[model samples]
Each structure stands twice: as structure tokens, then as C-alpha cells.
Target: ILAGYYILGFSIYSSILLAGLFASQTLIAYPIVNKLGIARDKAVTIAVGGTVITDTLALLLLTVIVGMATGNVDDTFWWRLGISVLVCILIIVVLFPIIAHWFFKLCSDNVSQYIFVLAMVFLGAFLAQLAGLEPIIGAFLSGLALNRLIPKTSPLMNRIEFVGNAIFIPFFLIGVGMLIDYRAFFRDWESLEVAAVMIALITVAKFIAAWLTQKSFRLSKDQRTVIFGLSSAHVAATLAAVMVGYNVILGHTPDGEPIRLLSESVLNGTILMILATCIVSTFATQRGAHNIAVKNALQTNDEEKSRPEEHILIPVANEQSVDELVGLSATIKRAKEPNGLYALHAIDNRVDDPNMEKRARKLLDGAAKTAAAGDLYLQQLLRYDVNIANAIVSTVRERNITDIVLGMHQRTPGSTALPAIPGIPGIPGTSGPGIGKMVTDVLSQSNVTTFIYSPAQPLSTIKRHLVIVPPGAEKEAGFQMWLQRIRQLARNTGAKVAFFASDATLQHIRPRRERKAPANIGFVPFDRWDDLPSLEHDLRDDDCLWFVMSRRDRVSYHPAMSRIPGYLEQVFAGYSAVLVYPVQAGATDRYL
Candidate 1:
């Protein structure tokens, strides 16, 4: 408003409407950032956030201006607008997310889900019209509502973005472009002057906003440039405001013609401004994204050079569990470390039949196929050994595998459930001497982290993680690594992690998580590990359980560790559960 009044010498009403046009920005250059694989960076995030908040306010402001221009500025109109907007927001913000989650959970068809999401967008716009607001406003709110339900890296999100960029967005851009009259810039000086002014005002205003944010927050120069680039594009709401103003006739001219809220020259100027800002935003975003990607690559290389590469081993035996096991390993391994994943199928030599080795080798093929489906590299290992646990332990030693994901079978009380390493000989346990002994042998002997997993459902179906952090879990060497893996799992699954730990343990976890944690993760104080039995009430069908246990020697280990297997056999049989035994930090000595 200030720019329009002081610089353009406009009336108060026109100034307010024009200012609203510039306040909102469209994500015109988001494709550039996404293409460069830096869409998840901090700079791009803040820019997207600013766009959502500013556009909502600007759209409402435009609505008000249009309402007044239509001669509906009475007290009743104001009250109606307030009540309708409130109702609209409540319906979309409160109910839309709930409905979306329910739909996604119950339906797994990809085509159906895509159709549903598109329908929601249109439905939201229709709902906004019912509330007497612009349909565009409701569409924006729908996106913000369902944003968290879809992970950026997931296939569903990729499909959504693909269709949008490929068809919908391009078609919309073409429609908007057709509104621009090329002859006006060449033939009319007034149109040219107005375009130049609008372009200058938007560019300068957005740059200043980005600059002030960078200075206040102490961000990098490239990040500041990224923020400016993303926020500078004057589209969507800009077009809406300008078109609304141009269409709404306020009075009659002395010449017996209509006096629109915005003149023809201004409308032409707004489109020209859109063209100029999008061009600039594209180039700026490209440059900024490139520089940021380069810096991240360098930093990651440095860190990887300093530490051992993260490697995870998955042992697959059950044909039905092959995909589940590979999925768990993918969750734990870093995205960059593709070569570190290995799937082993151990043959029991005691069976004596040559066909036993063939069957064992066939399981590894299923693991390979499962890994390939996810675009991951899994080096398959078919080892002939007397004990499956021995084969896993030997492979870890030879390959320097840092983490082991061992799958477990369903068990009833006093039943030997794990058939993968079935009938293995080891120290006697309460769950009999089969799966329990094999699990104990692997955990008792291996210095590296080992994950005992029994998946009752698909990983994508998981909604929440109920993690039990033993009192001294933070003292373990793999605490940071395991916690990071859990965080990654939460991100990929779109599930929140709830940490149940003592105050002292939370103190350690909070700082580590603060460095690079998802916003959805929460901490709860639970000092007594004995209260684990009470977890039956908290176990939902969609919840995954994580028990952070330790080896026999550490300060983190407790008598409760010995009973976890029995609890899984009885109390938590049907639920997805993982018993994580993390390795000590730098203790060169072996446990056994």
C-alpha cells in the first residue's frame, strides 16, 4: 500500500489492493530446487513457509477489496465474511487432515490415492466457495493440511509432483500467459511504465525481506539468495488480486464508461511483472541450489572420510519376510552408503541334504529382488555353516558389518518361533533352545549393533514408533547412530517417534536430536523399565515397538534385557517389534 500510494500516486483503495497483489508469491522456481535435490534444504523450506502464510493473508485481503468494490461493505457483510472464513478454515485445517489420513490408511491403491488427493483439492476449493471465499484460498490450505502425510522422497509424493509439474502446472501457466497482451508493451507507454514500476517494487521488496531474514538469522549468503529467489516470483495470488480488481467495476466515468478498481494498464503491467519475476527467480534458484548442493556434497564427503562407512546386514530365511527385512535394512542404512548393505542366507549343515543349500541360496535371491525393487544394492551372501548365527557372526567379521537386522518368526509361549536359525545349539533359555539361543548367541558375541525384528505388518502402514530407551542407553557407542536411524525411519514412514526414557537419558537424547531431528519426535519421561508390561494398553495396531537394549556387560544392560524375548513371545506377539542392541563406542574388548 505504501509503495502504491507514494510511488504510483494511487487512491487508498487502489493502493491497498495493489499491495496485496505483491505480498503473496508463488513457488515458480521450486522445480529448479527440486531438480537439484536440494528441496529439503533450510533456505528452500523457509521460502515455502513464507509463501503459504503470505498468500493466505493476501488472498483474504484481496477478497475484502473485491467485496467493497462490489458495494458490499456493510456491517453485516463484515460479520458474514468473518464467520464464513472462520468456518472455512476450521473445516479444512481441522477436518481435512483427519479425513486424508483415514483415507490413506484404509486404501493402498496408488491410482485410487492419486485420484483421492486430486479430488480433495477440488473439494477444498468448492468448500471455500461455500464459505464465500476464493476457491484458490481453500486449495492452498488443503496443500498445507496434507503436506506431512506424504513424504517428499516417497513414490506417492513423486507421482503427485510429477503430474502437477507435467500437466496441471504447465496448463495453468499457459492460461495465465494468454492473459498478457504483447502489443500493450510495444504500443502503449503507460503500460510500459506501469510494468517497469511493478517489477521494480516486487523485486526490491522481496530482496529486502530475504536480506533482513538472513541478517537476523545469520544464514549463509547462498541461502539468502535462495530465499530471495523463491519468494520473488509474483504469480497465483498476484494474478488473482489483479484480475479481481480489474473485473470489479466501482463507479461510472464521466464518459459513461465503467471505472474498474484497477485500470487496463495496471493489469497489463501485472502480467509483465509476473514474467520478469519468474525469469529472475528461475535463474537465482538454479544458482543458489547448485551452490548449496555442492557445499553439502563436500561436507558429506568430509564426514564420511572421518568415520567408518555405515554398513547394515540383513539375514533373510522366510520367503514371506524377505521384503520386510530388506525394508528395515534400508531404513537403517544411510542413503549415500549403498554398497554397505548385505543380505545373507545361512545354510544349516546339520540337515546334510544338498537340497538344503539350494533352498538357502533361493532365499537370498528373493532378498536381492526385494532390494532391487527399492533401487537399492544388496550383495547377496549364501554361506554354508553349521549354525545360522555362526554364519551371520562370521560374515560380520569378514565384511566389517556394523549393524545386523535378524528377522524373527511369530511365537507362542514355550514355542520355538524363529525358523530362520531354527534348532540352533546354544545356552538353554526359557523360550527353549532354538530361536532364543540363536538370538542370544548373535547378541552375546557380536560387538556390532544387532536388531532383532519381527514385523507384523508393512513398514508403510506404521503410524507411530513407541521406543523404550533404557536408563543408560545414551552411554552406548551406537546411541547416536541408532537414534539417527530411528529418525530416518520416522521420516520415510511419515510416522512420529515417541521416546519413553528417564529425565537423565532424555537430557542426552534432546541435544543429539536437536542437531538434526524431525519436528514430530517427542520425549516422555518413564524411569521405570518395569512399567514395560503396561505398554499393552498403548500398543495400537499401527504402532511399531522399539526396545533399546544393551549387551551383558554395559551400564545400560539390566535384568529386563533377559526377559524381552519372553515378552515378545507372549505380550507383543502380533505387533511389529525391534530389540536394538547397540555396540559400545570405542571399547576394543569383545563382550564374550
Candidate 2:
């Protein structure tokens, strides 16, 4: 019996056809609204409202069908049915005032509209059950009452309505479809006639309602016509009604035998009607909306064909060297193309230096002037007391920055002079706050696009250099962007690209392969440090080696591997003869 019920339930509740119908209706409604001079929001509201009525109609139809199917119509004589309805009405009247008052109090702040709507729906269902009426009738009345109580613009109201449309409505449609055996309609001609009758009745009822509502509202002829067109749409509620009618109201067959009162054919026919009506309503409304929108667009006065694109903010830290700052500013200017630029500078209060603010302003002024010279609109701002990185990130989000071009200086230990290894406290030869590390860390947390300007050999002078190492898994994002830039730079300079991947990363290498280098690019896969000699031999003809450093310690051959002095010395010695290109700090680093 449970299995039988499950099968029956599944047949009545399936809603794939209903979903398809709704989708089709939405498509059709778009153009109609555009034609009707209705705003997009209004058009959507109308379409949704039209679709919603289907639910109520389905409930009403189901109630009637169930009575007939169960032979309960005879049991509940006309007088008793009338009394039941009166009792239901009485329950509603007694409960509505209390419910409305409670809802108003609960939603006084206008933040609990969703909760209120849900409360009312459930309350209605419960009350209807107590009054021996269909729960859906109560649900519908609850929705209607809540809709009247809640202001249209209330966020809570909008949220609740959206939830219903997204969740409950779809589930209800699917439930309706599952209850019906679609195949039965094909076998029974009577099912088609029943469906046709239902469709006619629904259409006539909606038409009458639309006409009456328009007359009462004193709407214009066009408005009435549009409303009428929109009112024809039906889906979710209709399906739910059909399900209840078939499964609950019209009792299923006894002893697994077919019952004439609530046949599978009726359910199938209803599903088909839902699909057809939805399609018709959608197309009609969309065509109307589209035509209206196009007409409005055409009527608008002619203006400038192209307006200047709005500027996007790009934050710059004051700590950058003059040359590094200039290069980044230049890059931003070039990338702006037709759009203007806004350069923001944040003054970190943590910096105790008295001259810090003045210095930051000076740097920003110079950068702005440089950017402006390249036809980029540049604006500068100075914010106080906040962390430099946090401030920059906040400014990017608040001001809607498009991209960030940051100049990150590598912190090396020891001597400021050339070739002197800067000693770091924890690691040998690395000292101070590493700007590259900070920038990369920031990049991981940021949504804004970042371009780290590291020093490298000048593009003009560099010839036939290999983009050393395929991108390691750890540094895929940074490496890919770097490779693409290098590829472009190589194209301009007429240079070659060489890619190398560690043996562990060999399988991960794509776009570039090991050993067999492309005409313009070369790939080498190596594991042992000793293999560098052979790789060097292959690249001996190349003028320069562009070593793409992985950000992570695993693939990074620097400070992490510094502890293994012998291995480091061997790897360093392997490229001793070649112009070794470490990740450059600025354009000068590239040129030098």
C-alpha cells in the first residue's frame, strides 16, 4: 500500500513539464512587456503575478475534483458543504485580525516580512484543516492578506516572495506533475476533452477577472489589454491544485483499480494544459514588453555617440622608489586606453616619520602628472592611521578600482651595493620586510587584479632568452600571467621562450612540453640538479635565461634552498655563463 501510494504520489508530483512551461512563458513574456512600454521591473512583476494565479486555480479545481472522485460530494450534502465553507469563513474572520495585528507588530521594523508571510501561510493551512477545508485555500488567502499588509518596496517582502518563487513554487509544480501519468492522456480521448474544458474555463475566468479588475482600477485601454495578456500565465499554483485534487480530494482507485472520478488521464491532461497556457502567456507578454522598450529607446534624443568611460581607482603605496613608481604609473596609464584613472594614496599612521604624509603626497602628485600626460585621468587621495595593505584593499573595494599595479622591491640581505647579498635575520642574505612577499600575500586575499612590477632585463636589449621553468602547481596563476606577458614581450623583441618543469611537475605541464622546444619556445623537464648542465648546454646558444620563480618554497630555488649550500652553489654555477635573469624588481632591473 505504501509502495502504491509512493507511485501515485510520484506520478502526481512530477513537474518537469511544468518547469518547461514556465520557462517558455518567461521567454514569451519578455518581448510583450518590451512592446508595452512597461519598465523591466514592472514587466517581471506582471509576469510573476500572472504565473502565481495558476496556483490558486489549481487548488480550487482540485477541491472540486476530489469531492467527485471520493463520492464525498454526496456524503457532504449541499447544506453541509455550505456550512463547512461558512465555518471556514468564520475561522478566517476571527483569526485575521489577530494575525494581522501580530504581523504588523512583528514587522514593525519592516525587517521580518519573510517570517511574517511564512507564519501567515502556515497559520492559514492549520486553520483550514481545523475548519475542514483545503489547506491550500487557507494558504492562498494567507498570501493574499500578507501581500496586502506588506509594503511593495519592503526588502523583507521581496525576499519572502523570491523564496516562494525559487523554492515552494517549483516544488509545488514538480509535485503536481509527478502525480499524473502522462501516458494515460495518449490512450484516452476523454482526457483531451477534459483538458480542453478546463483550459476554456480557466481562460474565461481569468479574462473576466482581468476585465473587472481593470474597470475597477479605471486603467487605460492599453493597460487593460496588457494586464489581460499577462493574467493568462499559469504554472506553479495550478500544478499544486491539480496534485491535491488528484491525490487528496479525489480518492485514488480502490484495490488498485482505475477510478473514473480521479483517473490518471485527468492529471496528464492538466499537465498539458499548464504547459500550453504558460507558453501562450509568456510569448504574449514578452512581445508586448519588448515592443514598448524599443519604442522608448527610439524616441530618446540623440546624444554623443561615445562618452568617456568612467575612471577606476588604483591605489599606490608611498614606499616605492621613484623609478618603480613611475613604471607602474606608466603601465596603468597605458592600460586605461579610453578610460580615465584615479590614483589613490593611503597615509599609514603607523609610520611615525613627520615627513611621511608630505612625501606620500609628493610621490602621488608626480605619479598623477605622469599618468595625466599619457591621456589618463589621475586622482590622488591620502588616508590616515590605517594599515597600508588593508587601506589599499579597502580603497580598491570602496572606489571600485579595476586593477592594481604595484611595485614590489625584493628584500635582499646585506650590502646596498650591487652583487652584495642582503642578509636576512632568519635566512642568509635576505633582510627587511620583503615587498614581493607582501605584494604576493596581498594578491592572494584581493579580488582586484594585481600586476607586480619586478626588476628584469630590458626588453629591447634582451634577445633569444628562455622563459625558464614551466609553471609549478603552486605558482600557476602568477606564472601563467608572467608567461603570457613574456610571450608578448618576446614577440615584440623577436626573442625565444624556454620552459622548464621539475620532474614532479612534469605531468602537470601543459601548453609546453619538455625537451622538444617549439620553434620560438623550448621546454625542459628536469629533476636532479646535475641535469642543469645538459639543460644549460641546450640553452647555450640563447642570450639570456628568464627564470620564472615559483612563489612557494617548494619550487623556489632561493632562501628556502639556501640551507643546502652545495646544491645551491651547483645550481648557481650551472647558469654562471648565461646572463641569469632573476625576477627583476623594476624596469631598470630589467634593463640592467
Best TM-score goes to which candidate?
A: 1
Number of clashes in model 1? 1
Q: Which ten residues in a row have the lowest lDDT in candidate 2?
A: 576-585
Per-residue CA lDDT of model 2 for 312-368, tens digit only, reads 445566443433344333432323143455666667676787687787788778766
What lDDT score is found at residue 165 in candidate 2?
A: 64
How much is the lDDT of residue 160 in candidate 2? 71
- TM per prediction: 0.80, 0.38
Q: Which sections of candidate 2 miss by over 4 Å?
A: 1-113, 185-225, 244-256, 293-592
lDDT of all predictions, in order shown? 0.79, 0.48
lDDT of 1 by residue, 1-592 (tens): 8877887777788999998888889998988887676877778889998998899889888888888768778989888989999998998988998888788767755578789888888988998888877789888889888776765444457688778989988998899889988887778698888889899988999999999989987889999999999999988889988988898888898998988889888899998899999999998888888999999888678765765777789988788777777878876666545567898988877677888778877888877766665556789888889897799889988998888898864444785434332232332234333236677677666778778788876665667888999988887878877887887776566678899999999988785437455577888898777646678887787788999987666778776666666667666767888988787754335533
Which ten-residue region of model 1 has the weakest summed lDDT? 419-428
